[model samples]
Target: MGTWIKETDKAIYLMDGAYYLQKIDKTAHTGQVEGETFFRTGQLKTWLNSKEPPGFFLVSVGTGVSEPQPLPPPPAPPLSQGITITKSPSQVKIYQPYQVAGTASTSLVGKTVELYIDNSSSPAAKTTINDNQQWLVQSVFIAVPKPQVRNLKVVAGDASDVATLTLTPYIEDHPGGTKLNLGGSVGSGGSNRASDVRKVQERLIALGYTFANKNYETFVQTIRLFQSIISGRTAVRGVDGRIDVNGRTQRFLEAANAPQWMLMPSRGVGFYNLEVIDQPWDKHDYGIDWMSNVIKAAGIHYELAYRKNREGIAPIAVNDVSLPQGGDTIDHAGHETGNAGDLALPRLDGDFGGITWSDRRYDRPATKAVLEALRAQPWVNKSTLYFNDPVLINQRLCSRAAGHDNHIHFEVMVPPTP
Candidate 1:
């Protein structure tokens, strides 16, 4: 039960499980006396003491009594080592300028910290450790031409760490715009920057365009062709083949570079006549591959039923599925994920018609056959089909909703990988 007592000059003592300080005046033995009383065994007494400038001493009270033992010194503080990276996002835009920050050990202070991308030997960027053992490489730019996952390795002295970041398309803020600049000259008869042309070509390739070379001539031809396609023009006479950093071409390129969901080709045995609406505000008609497969199967089923009896079967008019990148669209919900599609109801008289939810001519038999085909798809189940047809709802072929009286909306169960 002895306690420690602090005295002048960093000294401490323990007595009777308690601590008491001794005044070493020699003139006054008023405090606990500093004389030792040996036990009958004749062993020297010991006590706890701090290893500072002034050491501690033990004072014995009487013979046959043991001195209180001092507690062991506390363990030393752990050494600060190992570099750790922190405070960075796990994802960034392709052309964004980001900062990599971390702390280094004191031993590594003033040493160089290098950042490597994708395990490249040469450092992409570097910075010196400050006196506080902190390092930061600011305004680090990664020129990613496409969407991908990349690794960043930081090393300082013997300490190192790594981080992963996903790079998306570099879409600039158009103040309600969604475009990115090409950043260098791109076109024919111009000083073609290879890097800039490569970016353009990558985007073109993503959007189903062909560019064989990275030279100015090839770039100019590609640009002209692209302009004509987007403009819906047959002649390329007035379409300029040049694109600067920021322009309509850049905006289109940005949109083209976005992630794509594969659209089912407009071809099949008995279902090749389906028309995909190509309107400006509704130009994009893409969805997950599985959804496309579902649509294709349903169309074939509809056509087969007509061929079996030689009865006239109207072609199914397909509406929007999702945008190029699978996001929100005007006048619709739940299509943001690219798993939903809308098909206009067929006409009873075997004629192509528009979207109609409640019209009496809404061909109930053909619509039912289409639903059966969709539900038969491996990826479709009871809850995947949406329609407002009372008969279909009663039969549990589809769930009823308020606005689906004229059309059928089908959403796949799972979103396929991009």
Candidate 2:
């Protein structure tokens, strides 16, 4: 009952019925190996040392485990990809049952895989298979009405013998036009620059997207708008492959996802709602959805960032909130200061106790809404809001953090020191 090792496959050999045994080197003596031939000890001896093939077990045992999982019939090769909902389809309308399908190739036969729908507040869409690994979502799942988008994801198992699948339903060139370009341009309008890049990263994190510490891929991964435009994926590429979306529907959706901002008052530390950027502009623009789901009825606008630090702060100017004393302030100084953003809310928008400007209650609703939205994303490590203040944000809105009166400041605080 000795064992043998195969030079090819990196599999192990077991001496006895004990399952986890490792490979034993080939011995000069001969006997029957489980994998070579089924002959008992006598017959195996005749073949050994002759040019005859080695014993079955000695040759290579097929525990049947190494066989690659049989693949589903082929429709589209299973794609091991990640997905995101830049614009979640909250409204479920009644669309007729249309077929949803995907394909993948696997070596294993008879193995099964679990198909999943991403973050579905609804149930798992109905899934079934056509003859050759072609999979589809049955009508029961399609009962969900339309005009809204759905994301699809599939994972192969028994232990991933194949790549995974990530599928998302988006408004495919709805109403407007159609084009797909993939390139980057300098000074291309829209809030598509530094701040927006950070915001997009924030949203992706909240929706459960992982990333590396290196900035290159993070930047690319964060903004789907950019990826769509630059990677030749979405319709951002105009007819002639022009790299632009100055003011398009897809851009509108992308911008809608950008973050909204607040300013630490020009008069004092208190924060205020000045203007909203709707979305972080492109790489040269401003938009929070470009960041995360954090949103206001409007979106992000913060202090224009001053130079010198405040007490626990820094220098001056028109915080993205507003211009103090109203001088004809025009130039956007290149100093991009980053502040941490916080809100103890969930991925879904928060109905924070803080009052909004329109709410007109004791709570400073506008500031409350903005701050609460920020709290929902993983990107915003820390932030200061204008809620504590009776004026900027009504106290009613703030269930915690007292109320950010002077101004809600967000600092990108890092982990602890060893």
Clashing residue pairs in candidate 1, if any? 1-17, 2-17, 2-18, 3-17, 3-18, 3-19, 356-406, 357-405, 357-406
The C-alpha stretches of model 2 lying farther than 4 A from their native spots are 1-367, 382-404, 411-418
lDDT of each: 0.55, 0.30
lDDT of 1 by residue, 1-418 (tens): 3333333322233323343433221122344656422222111122334332224334442343433345545699765666777545555543233556667678788887777776588877666766666665533332444335666777776545443433233544322223334557577654567777776776665554444255656557667755543443323336778776666666655752232346644656444324344454564466544456556655554454332344677655567665553334566755654456677677877754564646776788777767765664544545757888777788888997777777777765532211
lDDT of 2 by residue, 1-418 (tens): 3332232133334333323233333333345664442223443344344463333453334444352222234498554432212222233222112223344343322234334555554434332222244433311122322523444544433434433334333322222222222133312333445544444345434322334113643434334333332222212222221124433322422432222222322222223222222213312122222221222211321111111122322111112321221111242221122122222211112222233233433233334434443342223333333234543333333332543333343422211110
All candidates' TM-scores?
A: 0.37, 0.21
lDDT of 1 at 11: 25
Specify the highest-lDDT model's number: 1
Error of 1 at 170 (Å): 37
Model 1 — which ten-residue stretch has the worst lDDT?
Answer: 36-45
Candidate 1 off by > 4 Å: 1-260, 270-281, 305-309, 355-357, 415-418
Backbone clash count, each prediction separately: 9, 122
